[model samples]
Target: MERSHVPVLPAEIVEFLKPDTTNAGPVVDCTLGEGGHSALLLEHAPDSRLIGVDADATMIERARYFLGPRASQVEFVCAWYDDFWLSYTGARPHRVLFDLGISTFHLAGSGRGFTFREDEPLDMRLSDSVMSAAELLSGISQEDLADIIYVFGEERYSRRIAAAIVRARSSGSLRTTGDLVETVASAVPAAYRRGRISPATRTFQALRIAVNAELERLRMALPRALAALSPDRGRMAVITFHSLEDRLVKWAFRAAAGDEAAVGRSAVTAKHSTASKFAPKLIDTVAMPEGERITVLTRRPVVPSHEEVAGNPASRSAKLRVVEKTRIEESW
Candidate 1:
């Protein structure tokens, strides 16, 4: 099958970003998977430049090809967002977009086991620098593995699944995605296995998150992204697929926006909330600012429209949150 990616929330992104028409600054795409979103953004605002960043080298090449000569206006960087943010010395971005969902290329062709339907190797690393999911599972302790699954995947049967994996590893049977999927299926209850969603979904998601250190990377990149935004004129949008990611974006933006009402309503302290039970450790990973620097454009995350969901089932879980940098006061 041909690999293709449908940029989620296209109309909303263009509508909200309203990319600077005068080429005032670049619109940075932190997760330039297939470059669908960036291409659309450029097309909408022809004068806008793009700074597209992706960790996968294949994605970089593909995005370059996809962008054609328009790629000249885009700076395609092959590095993880956090690293790219650290070394970046570019014009302040008027718009920044981060679509955290995995790309269709990885799901369909890269064969890194993003999809459980395929019996590929259990290597979910987004880049070659990190340890593959297979290596991670085979090396970690059962307790730690269970914690990772429970925290990142929010899988209720994480303990059972971890125990099964340990046993399978001892027998040298847990090497491929098929093995992991079977192990998870055997660990969960019959009802859970028969549920609408695959029993392996959570486990696969957890493995992918751990292998990519996704949460950690996001935590590191958010602050830098905020700093890069052009005050008063900058807009940033983030699309998260999972609860852990959504919560991080929600609170981080809330704190930055200084939305006292939202912060007051948080179950735990905005600075440090371990209330999730699932990803308790992640609360500390993201440092929420105590003061205002931006405006939360969306009170709640924007979900995919019914029409969009019907067209692309994979986009059903997408939640988009936007924020705009607050105007700076000149120090006379």
Candidate 2:
């Protein structure tokens, strides 16, 4: 909780999305990590109703404290964003934001082994009900694990990393974040170990994605989010951290904006591979949502300025994409 999460593009988000100024809004923050983004959004449109959702209870509590008196305007929901949206039957949202991917809270504070630098339990479940990373590594096949690391993490050394994990499992050494890091370190080449990015980074990311079902949930949640928007003026902004997430968001937005079908790579398939060796049919075949379309507000993704990134290096890879809902017949 001591490590505060800086919302990636604070000014850009507020400037792009037009939240209801009539005090009759219910702007939903789908991934309310540390409440930084929601706090600023509420401050910008003080009268708007706020519904903050986060899978981690720790994050929820911290966000609640951070929001302080603004808590009165918020309806805090401790649930996955997709799960929350699936059953939600409240007033349509005036504006919605999805700050996708893990935040600093996960790496530094969540004791969930989201960080390879940490020596915590390999329990990377964003929600409580799912299997932890430790459990996943224990039971999964090396080939399937390699595929996940390749397709999800885009790691070139996926086969090596997965094989190392399998070997570590036999010795019961894949129990914690540090153990996994050591295993990854031992598997990859020495040069790769000393690369700019840590060797374990992609493996950890892939494991978290698998354990939390992040991409699957994102696909399910996008159309629902678009549907939840107020048709007249509802806008949704998504900030993705990596290539995989950005690709998914781009395809979904294109579909909503009336691309014939935003068909793209199956979540499990690698571009070089014919098909996924493991996992179900995870192809994205998105289309217009319920006879409605959207106007993609961002022609190109907005990136953090050099000044911002210099101040906060973690913000360097962030990309913000925004969309506004419109009737099918309406032309921008």
Candidate 3:
């Protein structure tokens, strides 16, 4: 089936980021992709302007074209999300979105190795400035490779796959998407190879994550995003495509919402400190320091509906989490 230019959970996003009709301000779309979400935001919130950011220059142009006449309402920035957010000097945004998934155009047209279905160069970089996946694989140690695959991809056979990759690269054979796919297929059991998904899916995902330093970028961007919100009622939404990204969003949001458990080990130290004899004075001195800045709108991540998935299977794994800034004074 031909896919529509539908951003996952479009309705949910528009609703979650519903601007005050009287004074809707700018929205920052940190992962502009094809600009589907930004276009929709412009359509839904007439008063809202969009600051669209993307790492890929090609994708930024594509988004500009996709947005067309509505492009007037957007300011496109070809840069990584963290760089754009950290350096932004404009007015605070009332809405922000980070859809952390590769666009359809990226998979189907990028000629980059985002998909194992096609034979492309092993250059799964989001931008030309970053190292290519092939270069990364060739230089990475098997231990580091396995750690990346297991941690980012959550694939159990990471060790075997990493070993196979090292073997293939040592023989100067692992240079393209096809080579990596073949390596992974041979590394896993035949029964596993016959599964519904491609055997190399996890490996590709891991390489892309590592090449882009995607997780680290997200960790740095989230707090900046929270701080960029218009005080009192700004809303931010992040749509993650996999478990690892989702976990980062979940924990970050929980921490912003001031959940003690979300602080994990740090919470214990604070707890013990508060129990000491001088605790009252300490707490009183910094009474407002630890107040929550955000209220998580969705207790559980909002996933694509079955009907939406039926229409666009690429969105099947998309999970959207949203939060609203509580006040201007509650900066992270």
> Against the true structure, whose TM-score is highest?
2
149-219 per-residue lDDT for model 2 (tens digits):
98778899999988988998998777788998999999999999999999999988888888988888898
Model 2's alpha-carbon lDDT is: 0.83
lDDT of 3 at 149: 80
After superposing candidate 2 on the true structure, give the runs of residues whose Cα lies further than 4 Å from its correct spot. Answer: 1-3, 264-274, 277-291, 328-332
Clashes of each: 0, 0, 0
Order by TM-score, highest first = 2, 1, 3
Best by lDDT: 2
230-320 in candidate 1: lDDT tens per residue?
A: 7746899999998878887887677566555444333223433244443433322222333326878898899999999999988999999
TM-score of each: 0.90, 0.93, 0.88
Q: For candidate 3, what is the lDDT? A: 0.79
lDDT at position 147, candidate 3: 75
Residue 80 accuracy (lDDT) in model 1: 97
Clashing pairs in 3: none
Higher-TM-score candidate of 1 and 2: 2
Enumerate residue pairs that collide in model 2: none
